[model samples]
Target: MSILREARLSDLPAIETLVKAAYGHYVDRIGTIPGPMRDIDDHRYARHIEAGHVSLLFDNADGEESVDAGNGDKPVGLLVLIPQTDTLLLDNVAVAPSAQGRGFGKALMQAAEARARQLEFDSITLYTQELMHENLAIYRRYGYVETHRAEEFGLKRVYLRKSLA
Candidate 1:
């Protein structure tokens, strides 16, 4: 079974490591450290975690089945969700590359949507680097429609939104 919970201050280091391992390969594909890694180093996640906007997904809660290939205690995926005036923003959703294809990413997406409803938001918004076609396909498959494309934060980004109501 997989477990999802809010991230605590103590989880910062693990989240940083997991995020780097998850998005690190993009450096070659996009030519530069991904935004998340840079943000990690800047202690951005520290503020997010403190604000309760981060959630971690862990596999193998039962100690019998390890979703992270036996490293059950380690988080396999994470989601950073922040509430906006009328939309819930999906700041980031990352799954350990090694843990891909095991549904952890899907679980985190579901969590984001669930949180949107909990916050009484009718829509969720997110963005990804334009070169991350893999993420674009996944987000489209999950019903996020492209809202626009623009350069933001030094990265060409594709913005998307999903409406729940």
Candidate 2:
């Protein structure tokens, strides 16, 4: 089974590590550091965790788990949520490279949706780099519709939204 929980202070380092490993591959593909890669760090994660904005995904399936046991439930995936007036912004969803293709990503996305509902949000919003076609497709498969496109921080982004109600 897999578990999703809000991050604690001790999980910041692992979160940062997982995020870097998850997003590092896109650096060369995008020809520049992805905004998430450049923006995420231990301090920021610490703040987010403290503010109740970060959640982590842990895979606990015996014999199928990939995380190290010594780390004490080290997270394989992460979700960063920012609550807005009427929506929950999924700022980031990342799965460690080693944990990709194991349904962890999809589970994390589902957890995000459940969280939005729990928080009384009517919708969820997110944006991905325009160059990351795979991510855009995955979000669409999750029922997120393209809301618009814009350039920010020198990168083209495709914004998407999904309604829960």
Candidate 3:
């Protein structure tokens, strides 16, 4: 079974590692076109965890009979969600490099949406670098529509939103 929970202070290191590993390639893959990806730093993530903006999702191999590969207690994936006045912003989503292509990102996002509704938020929002085509497509499939575009932190970012109301 997969579980979603609020990230605790202790999970900072793991979360940082996961985020960096998850997004570190974007800068290299896209070159300087989209500029840079900001969520790929360890200390940056530590700060997020300290500020209580991170959420964790763990997929226990044992709980999923179909997943024969065991990961012991390590988190296979994580989602960073920030709460706002009218929307829940998904700051980042990452799955372990060894565990990609298994729908972990999507499942984690679904949990985020549920949490947003529970918090009485009217919408969900996130921004992705133009270079991250796969991520943009995934968000689109999940009902997020492009809302804006900007260049932030040296990267061309496309913002997306989905109304829950």
Best by TM-score: 1
Look at candidate 1 and give me any clashing residue pairs: none
Give the 10-residue window scoring lowest on summed lDDT in candidate 1.
Answer: 63-72
By TM-score, is 1 or 3 better? 1
Across 1-165, the per-residue lDDT of candidate 3 in tens digits comes to: 676666776676666666666766775776753321354333566676777777777776567533211333567787777887879988877788878888788788888888789889989998888878998898899999999999876778899999998
How high a TM-score does candidate 1 get?
A: 0.92
Model 3 TM: 0.83
* Per-residue alpha-carbon lDDT of candidate 2 for residues 1-165, written as tens digits (9 for 90 to 100): 887777888887788788789889899898888877776643677778899999888887774544442467678899999999989999999999999999999998988999999999999999999989999999999999999999988899999999999
The Cα error of candidate 1 at residue 81, in Å, is 0.2
RMSD score of candidate 3 (Å): 4.1
Show pairs that collide, candidate 3. Answer: none
Q: What is the lDDT of every predicted structure here?
A: 0.88, 0.87, 0.74
lDDT of 1 by residue, 36-113 (tens): 888887899999999999988888657654233133268889999989898999998999888999888888999899
lDDT of 1: 0.88
Clashes of each: 0, 0, 0
What TM-score number comes out for model 2?
0.90
